[model samples]
Target: MYLFLSDFHFGLGTPEAQARRRQDFFACLDHYADRLEALCINGDLFDFWFEWKRVILKDHFSILCKLKGIADRGAAIHYLAGNHDFALSRFLQDEIGAQIHRDEHVFETGGRRFYLQHGDGLAPADWGYRLLKRLFRSRFNQKLYSLLHPDFALEFAHLCSRTSRNHSSRRWDVDGWAYREAARAKIHQGFDYVIYSHTHEPLLEPLGRGVYVNTGDWLKHNSYAVWEDGVMTLKYWGMPWMERSQEEGYSKRQVGTG
Candidate 1:
């Protein structure tokens, strides 16, 4: 069984809220840890994450330990970089045995081919964001930013993340056409499922012969997805199961079993 989640944006909320959400997230992990074949974090686990040589973000320490414990229990950990948390490096890999993917991850599991991405730059009209992504991801720029004190850098990054998030919310299209189109293109290329999570809206739409899933975010929906026995289903944090439909239209029915 594979569990997929995204867009926690851990540092975006108040300290008390963040702690409560973190504990709930930890409980979900603990519940599923022993049965999971892999735990895939699709993106934006942090609001902003940048690690200096000797300074790492301590806010993520407890969750990181929980993830490491899951890894130690025999589930592979796959952390895909999201727009907000794109500064990820080797710390997760070294400490939690995580496989960090910068943009997308392609894998075969349960006899199915899955394509996973954070759904950031897939839209052609998002040229400005694409350019900014390049600038922020430049190795030289990262090196220069790393020269600043970690405390100041993190504070600035968090402020920027908040502003950017506000701006994005104002302009975000709830229909999510770009993500659906992207999934359509990938499904034509032979993937059984295309998963994404930047829009923060949960979706499970059938496109051609394959399916498209957006794992949604922990902020409002607390949604996730699971792939098991050759089928994938989107679920809420407290739901045990959501039955999948094969028809063009998808409908979710909650069940009582894992």
Candidate 2:
């Protein structure tokens, strides 16, 4: 089985909320560690991640350790960069054994071809953001930003992220038809599944003979997707069925039980 999740946006809320969410996320990593053949964190695991030489956020230490443990256990870890964490550097790759992908990735598993990405700046309607994305991602801009003290830079980035989140939260229900159309195009190009996360809206829909899935956000829905036995499913970790098993939870016995 393979597990996929995204839009964690850790470090967004209050300190207490952040800690609780981190524990919940760690539980997820623990729950699937034994059964996973591969794990894909499609993006935004951090609300704003910027790495400087000899500098690491203390808050990410635990999660990084957990990820390293999972990778050591032999599950392939694929970390796709999202808009929020586009500056993701070598720490995850060098220390946690992750395969980093900056934009999109394609691979074959479970007898199917999969296209995976963080789904940012994909909609044609989001052309303004797309333009800004290019600017923000430029090496020159990144270098200029890196000149600021990490303390000030990180705090400012987080504040900007919070403001962006507040604006986006109000439009959560807006349909992402553009993304669907883009997925359909990929389906036509021979992908058996096009999986992405950014809209933070969970969806599993058939497109032609293929499928399009959005794993949603850990912040709001705690949703994720799984591929097992040639089938794919979108499930919420906080659902009744999962809640019932919270005590004796997530054993190998539960592998295909979901």
Candidate 3:
């Protein structure tokens, strides 16, 4: 089975809340560790992650160890860079055998082709963020930022992440249409499933012969998506994985994967 999750934003909350999120995430990993083919994190696994030479956020050590265990078990770890945690280096790959991708990743699983991306700055109207994305991704800018002390750099990035989250909360009501349209375009281009994770909203809207899936966010929904045997299901953590004959029979909080 291929398990997909996203938007963890680990450092955004109180210390206690962060601990709880980590424990929950660990439990989720443990539940599927034995059966996982590849664990795909769509984006924002951390609120802000940057690897300076010989420097990383010490708080993340435990979770990193847990992921290392999974990697040792031989399941692939695919980490797609999200807007919040895009500044990556070879640390993940070297330490845990992760495959880090800056943008989209295309692969075949269960005999279906997948188009996976972090889904940031895809809206035609989001010109400012698109430009910011370019600026943030520049090699020169990254090098300049690396000159700062790791403490100050990570602290500043966390503050920026919190501000970005607050702004996103303010605009949450109308945040997902652009993602859906983008998914539609990919579906029309012949992908069986187009998966994304920036909007923090879980959706399983059918587009012609394919499906558009947003794995949602760990912050609010604790939602994820699973692909097995050529079938995809949108699921919530700590809830029963109920299968229904009709899409409308599910709760309003649940998304239909049909």
Candidate 4:
């Protein structure tokens, strides 16, 4: 089975909040550690990802360590870059052993074809936002921006992550429209599912010829989506101690067991 999650948005809130949420996230991932064929993190694993040569996230170690353990057990990991965490360098690929996707990709599994993307620039309702995405992604600009001190740049980027110039009256409407269009185009090509994350919305609906899945974000509602065998589900992480502690959230985890 394949596991799908996205828009984690790490590093935005307080350190304590981040830690609590990360634990819940890891717990969910660990639950299916032994049965997964591959773990797919669709996008925005971190709120703002700018990889400097000497920089590191002190807080992500636990989460990374958990992923490392899973990889050691043999399930491959795939990461799709999100708008909030672009300009990824070599760490995730070389060190973490993840097959990283800078954009969308297609992979076949379980007798079905699946299409995946981070759902950032694919939504056209936010054309202005897409333009900024292009400017920020320019190689020249990335190089120029890389020259700033890590402290200053990281702080600035975190600030940028805190604020977004969203123009949509209803964000989900735009996301739904964009994903539907993508699904129609891909279904003609023989895909059974189209999965994406970035709008921070968890959606699973019947499309023209397949299913469109969004794994949602961990920032607020704590949601994700998963598919096992033929069962597709979106879960909120709720644990035994959920009401009092940080385990009060949802998760999207799947093990093929196929």
Q: TM-score for all predictions?
A: 0.91, 0.88, 0.91, 0.85
Error of 3 at 206 (Å): 1.7
lDDT, each prediction: 0.82, 0.79, 0.81, 0.73
Error of 2 at 49 (Å): 0.7
To one decimal, what is the Cα RMSD in angstroms of model 4 from the true structure? 6.4
Task: Please tell me which model should have the higher TM-score, number 1 or number 4.
Answer: 1
Model 1 per-residue lDDT tens digits across residues 101-186:
99899998667899999987666666667777888789999999999998889878977677556444324435677888889999
Please write out the lDDT profile of model 4 over residues 1-258, one tens digit for every residue: 788888777887888888888988888887788788889899888877777787766657777777788888899999888887777888888777888899987898777788998877666666767777887789999888889987788888866665442432247444467767876788778888888776676666666657667777787656665677665666556622211111222232322211
Model 2 misses residue 183 by how many Å?
1.0
For every candidate in turn, the CA RMSD to the true structure comes to 3.3, 6.0, 3.1, 6.4
Q: In candidate 4, which residue pairs get closer than 3 Å at backbone N, Cα or C atoms, i.e. clash? A: 1-256, 236-250, 237-249, 237-250, 237-251
State the number of backbone clashes in model 2.
Answer: 0
- Candidate 2 off by > 4 Å: 163-173, 240-258
Range of the 10 consecutive residues with the lowest summed lDDT in candidate 1: 248-257
lDDT of 2 at 245: 17
Please list the residue runs of candidate 1 whose C-alpha ends up more than 4 Å from where it truly belongs after superposition.
166-173, 239-258
Residue pairs in collision within model 3: none
Predict model 3's lDDT versus the native. 0.81
